[model samples]
Target: MMRALCLTGDPVADKLLTDDPFALLTGMLLDQQFAMELAFAGPQKIATRMDGFSITKIAESDIEEFVELCVTKPAIHRYGGSMGRRVHELALHVVENYDGDTEGIWTAGRPKPDGPEVLKRLKALPGFGEQKAKIFLALLGKQRGVQPKGWREAAGAYGDRGSRRSIADVIDAKTLVEVRAFKKAAKAAAKAG
Candidate 1:
């Protein structure tokens, strides 16, 4: 069963995230230099503006047009132009690598990839880096139930049970506040160090 996500406050946006793997991935990709709720809301904007969201459609879209859609009023992110390009590249990667199945990054292969392998695959995505990939892996294991062996270890600190570290741990308004507080404190500590 697919668990509902409350990353975006908007019910429509949150529903999209819960029902669409690519949307969730796109949300994670956009979850940078932006507020978490709005970042996760981006896919719904794209879906509404484009009439629908499809991996192949996005991948094959004209770059200029897609960027324009992304940078429209209430843009997907503060840096909509760059993020739009990144999203396009991500769609292309998904189509080429996983035949447009976002879940295949973790669920593919004969033996079914373990947690580390899934992390490796996620890290290879266009906008995903080390921490982002790990957080996303943790999100999958914790909320989306994509756990493979060693998942907790592979996710590093983000996988800690009952932790309020990242989006992986965000389940409601209260948890969102907790995560924000945690991130703020961590940022302060990093600066003080």
Candidate 2:
């Protein structure tokens, strides 16, 4: 079943992320230095520019030309140039490491297919740190239903059910607001502590 994600206000953009695992992964990669909705919408924008979201295509694309595509009009990210490089590199990494099948990273083919292994794999990806990897793992479990064993433990606080603290908990506009508030509070706490 395709899960409906309303993170991007635009239905088409959100649909692209929800329907394509690669797109979802790309969206997560783009989540930095940009608003959540805009970051998630990036894959759709790139698909529109490139005419598809094929990992092979992105990996093979010329870096300079891809950067131009990423910077045109409503740019893919706040820092389109660096982000364009990151996205292209990520596509190459996916192709080389996962055989161009983003699903393989989390699916049955995984050696362990458990939360810790999944987090380890995510952390190995470009642009993913410990916190980002854990949050993505939580998003997989909470929204995409990719719960391997010990997923909750691997995801840390983001795995808690009913927690409106991240994109995983965002189901609608109201929840989006809640997630933003939670992020704000967390940021403040980090700064204070």
Candidate 3:
């Protein structure tokens, strides 16, 4: 069994993330320009509104209707419409490439993929840039037990042990605060320089 994610304080949202690989990926895709916990909870909101979460359903959904779903009330992100489209595109990419097996990105192929290979696969996904790919790889290694050889190196700074640098290090409320602090400091330092 996969370990439960504590990204969102809400039990339902966190449970959805834990139970669904696609949901976890969606959350990571939504993590940009939004509060991390709320971003992670976006999948749960979609699951609730749509009656269940399915990557196929999301990919096949009418773009306008899907945008509406994302824009409804609380919304999936601050920029709901754009993020919704990105989510749709991500679903399509995964379906077309992995045949709906989200884990296949890491677990597929002869002799199994190593960390660099998995990172390359993640970088190919829609909305996953180099930094985002590295962070997700770190999350998989630290929490989801998707560690492949050289995972730590592929993940860069985010994979360092006990480092509260990104969502990968957030195991609880305390860690979330630590990550936020780290980001805030980094942003401040960048501005200062």
lDDT, residue 30, model 2: 91
Higher-scoring candidate on TM-score, 2 or 3: 3
* Stretches of candidate 1 exceeding 4 Å from the true structure: none
Stronger candidate by lDDT (2 vs 3): 3
Tens digit per residue, CA lDDT, model 1, 1-193: 2478899889999999999999999999999989999999999999999898888889999999999999998999999999999999999999999999999999999899999999999999999999999999999999998899998999999999999999999999999999999999999999999
Model 1: worst 10 consecutive residues (lDDT sum): 1-10
- Candidate of highest TM-score: 1
Ranking by TM-score: 1, 3, 2
TM-score of each: 0.98, 0.95, 0.98
Q: What lDDT tens digits, residue by residue, belong to model 2 across residues 1-193?
A: 2367788889998888788998999988999868998999999999999998878999999999999999998999999889999999999998999899998888746265888989988999998899888889988898887899999999999899899887878878889999999999999999999
Off by over 4 Å in 2: 108-112
* Cα lDDT over the full model 1: 0.95
Candidate with more favorable, higher lDDT: 1 or 2 = 1
Clashes per candidate, residues 3 or more apart or on different chains: 0, 0, 0
Error of 3 at 130 (Å): 0.3
